[model samples]
Target: MADNVIELHPTSRSDLLARLRDELPPAWRGPRIGPDIPGWTDPPGGHIHDLVLTGLPEPLLTELAWMAHWQQVIDGSPASVQPLNQFAIAYRRACDAGHELATSIQQIDWETGESLLNWYYTTRWKRFPPANTRFRLRAVFHVPRLALIAHCHQGHWWELDEWHPRCDPRIPIGPREPHGGRIIPAHITQPWLREAVKWHLGTQLEAGTLRWSTIGQARQLTRFDRWITVAFDDPCDVLSDPLAAPAQAAEFRRWAADPVNRAMRSCDRRHRAHRVHPRQVNDDLRAVAELFAFVAANTRKARAVLGASPWSAVTALHADAWRRQITPIRHQPMLNADHYVDDHALAQITAALPLLALPRGQHMLVTRGDGTTVTAEGFGDPQVMRMILLQILTGRRASEVRLCEFDCLTPVPASTDDSEGKSLTRFRYAQSKIDIAPDTILVDDEVVAIIEDQRRWVRDRFPTTTTNYLFTARKSNLTATKPYAAGSYTRLLNKFSDLLAIRDSKGRPVTLGHTHRFRHTKLTRLAELGLPIKVLQRYAGHATPSMSMHYVAQREEHAEQAFIATAKFKADGTRIRFSRDDHDAMHLFDRADRILPHGWCMLPPLQSCDKGNACLTCSLFATDATHRDVLQHQLDDTTALIDRTTTEFASRHRRPMPDDNVWLAQRRAEQQALTRLLDTLPTEPGQAIQGHGCPTAVTEPVPLLPDPTFPRRTRP
Candidate 1:
């Protein structure tokens, strides 16, 4: 996170291939797959080389693997050095042929519509908007071959909206074709149509007419076209029915467009109290229509084109199954850098973390009180973020305090508990519930200004929650509640990433990692500081060391620290001598006992001294090897602790009333001072194992928040 960071891009095509070689087996050559990279067929049913060498050499693919590292890091961002879209088209042919990055034909499952969808969408979405994993994967991986079917449905629906004719079905909106067939009209402004197109085109694949039975099955493509063709060819009886009266259609459109009705339908949505998100709504509405049109176009093909198969039997769709087939991606990590980790790209992410100084969260981008998103790596409410970062910055936790709620976020006396009026600005919210998540608060001075300014911007646009997005209209068919799910943080992040022209150290675009890398870097820094893993475990609200470990990444540093501290003996059975100054600076004490310098040398089933915790027989006790092992183990333990604590905290934090004040008090003081107290701490000295003992620095008590198992306080 310091300024001494390096970028990870302009990668060597040759080097990447070499690197990839390590990823695969020795003597590996062809593409990973069921089908070799597919190329376009010659005609109606033409098939070309299953795997074409074409003009491209292996190096380009290697460069692309590197490029994708940057691309995915930036959420599928286009590279400034090269236009990926230009080259990405080449991958499409392979995706169309049902190829993927997996190793064997056994790794494939043609029967899984979703798997097909992943291959289908990743290849295609790689071509355009909302730079992200979805787009990149859709560009090359999660394409939803069922997408064509989903599209066929969306397109069909869109066509019908126009085809049905608002005025009269017989009256075409567009000019007639030379053969006198009804043609789509020009200049018709049905906003709904646009919404539908976005949905159909976007990665939200609605399998519409081409429903798949599962996520795996290799020989399933044979049945796909048949199912689509039969459904398309089936005579639509509704077309024969008299078209709705112009007045009746107009009334339906009006009802559909009503904001009140849309809001009503979203009654259970936790964020309904917030207001309608016009862009999200319009996007959804238009998508629905586009999906219908997409469906129609593909299915309208000839029955002869289908060729009889199990797919042909799918003419009748069960509406529920059809709907279920289309699911919005449910994110687990909220933000994932797995694509960039361990590769050169990670350096940039680490650098960007401190530079952005955003809260950390890899999952749901944290929301600030005003509905602005935090650019962090790990998820948090704004207040929790302020507290955690405060700890990171100051290296101290609050001694005592309480979290309180006002009608809305407002500044109050920091000493409200006393009459001192020595004020700390605290933001409050009612306890969050399943139906209504907590509103966030901003406490950091730097972040508070940004949050307020962003809020003002939002206010200028909406004025009131009832007014909705000033930039857009909350039209019919688009529900208001969807934003809470997709998250304002995500939407806003796209805009911010674009505005900042931020790039990871990798020379790829930088967008999605946001505040997440910050969380990891900060946690790693904490581990380096020798903050007891238990302290970090509580600070992070984790249940165990493993869970907390995700945020702490510098294994080498921890090992080095432990190595120098514990390993100190000579062949003469005497301890290494240290000057008084060295002893004081590094915390060394004289003892007539054996020691291990680093825990690294310990074999599995490591032995411990007979004492309560091992003092001797530790690899750290040995001066022969550097004490890197103990530091590594310490980090691993801390990581586990933080991960466990955060999960428990998130769950308990969301729960309603607590019958036990003891449980509530444990975290209250720490939460209140988290933001203000952290700034006073020192940056880690980055020490390696040296001659040592306990220092005066140890005298200051570190406030510890217990993990999920909040221990009871004992009498002094």
Candidate 2:
């Protein structure tokens, strides 16, 4: 037994490495690894002292420039840290990543190609990691599982079109970079990916019991089958040919057309018992299948071209079939399932608030519908909080955010100042788990308020047990089922799309397909306001600009506005007075603005001036006088106010002065700048004029209404 085990595991080689390490002495270490500290190389003899404990996450990869250095192996007289057999396993895993990477990199220019190759070579190249480098990439990236498991894990998402699968390989999976030595041809991953798609489609079609012979009249499928065909093919059609290098597209097309992979058109149309279709629907499943088949086949071509992995060719072929030919067939109709919210768009909406993603175990304050706000258990809770945050930032009320759904919001952001005075603050969470599982819902300020208010009403009524989820599911005791998944504000976006009220330069209300979509709004605003990329990264809690981009798309106009409006302040509560301030994004208020409770009101601040007199120095300033006058004029003509034009119009401002002597004295200088406008304007412009009763300016509460859900402690 000992001999056999030794022969299998190579204990002698392990022993030899151990003996060599002991012989080398402590000072002669090659690399060090442990829980607290990452791996590092020893300057002495290049002996790698890797700390491989029972369990730990894979190390992070180094920058692209250092890929080669990451994969270097320590050269010993006759000893090495990883034995030959173990090395083979490691290489095998890396080969999978390489397979996927080959497809991703196939379109890169020579320079980018070289850089990526460097990234791989340094960390996993096996040449010899640099003297002090521990380049570890994601574990999943290293060992791509492009099959049923891959589809099950990540391959089968309905939004593959927008996700840009070919482009998305850049999105890193878990960490655990391969030793750069794994070199599989890229062609392998292509086919495997297709096969994985095939598995997903197969499973879903099997489970749904849908008929296939009923192809669309557009094709040959029946009405129901047509619906399924559209549902499945929509994504494929969108992804079939994206904006990429022509060569890549050509190569992709050729690979898809390869003889080894054949398109499946005629359907059996029979399930366990359900007879979906009596005869074959569309005898010809044209470009739809062609697209999938091509993508699947082409993906394989990249793998083969690049020598992606050691997976059998049959497996690769199967993968390609799955991605293109098979996966599209299943596409379980998202029956009774609410649509997936555009999370990135949600982040875009919350420009003023933080829209971030923290690692597992990170904590945040979350408020539930029952008004019970707590530092919830895990990311699940924070995700809930994110929904709330989205509502708050997008200017939705709690009730609105809670019930927000398709066609709820006005075309424009609701401000208290509008004549309706009451901006529509309403939204709803879409159904949860109707099809594939939906991400948790979120609550924004308005939604939080509604929940808090509802909680108070509930507490007054129930007075005993808690009712946390606003949209709670009710099931009979006899039908035991999965715990109810709560809906959140994050998904409320689609509900409020009508309320977005944004218009393009073309004067048309922009149509955002996804309902949960304020994230893009906020991000677009911030990006236009020229928030530093790094700051955007921090604000959005993105691991990198690349990752953040996956959520917030950049538009040229927004970029221009961001450049023109960016503002930075010093720690001393003073503006960083660079000449760039002219183009800097002007934060309307010196401090973050709070939504005042009594009245809806807020406008751009007075233009940058030396005591409000830089009017002459300013170039962008409209012919309007002191910005105060401009605002007052706009307010006076409030009924005719077309839109918020260049906020940089000339204006002098008075500070919002405090009531006390100390406060008055300190804020005296800027009092006219901030206070004059507030004192000058009435809460309701209509009432202010025509000798009607003057309405006090109603604004958001300061420090915000205490999250009614968060239990407040009494003073001792």
Q: Which tens-of-lDDT digit does each residue in 614-708 have in candidate 1?
A: 32212232221223354445445545654576568668897544435554443333232222122212221222212221111111222222132
TM-score of 2: 0.26
What would you estimate as the lDDT of candidate 2? 0.32
Top lDDT: which candidate number? Answer: 1
Local distance difference test, each candidate? 0.33, 0.32
Model 2 lDDT, residue 217, Cα? 21
Give the distance in Å from residue 545's predicted Cα in candidate 1 to where it truly belongs: 6.9
TM-score for each predicted model, relative to the true structure:
0.25, 0.26
What's model 1's overall lDDT? 0.33
Task: State the displacement of the C-alpha of residue 59, model 2, in Å, after optimal TM-score superposition.
Answer: 56
| Minimal lDDT window, size 10, model 1 | 397-406
RMSD of 1: 28.5
Q: Across residues 219-291, which tens digit of lDDT does each residue of candidate 2 receive?
A: 2212222223334433233233333223333333343333222222334223323422312322223323433
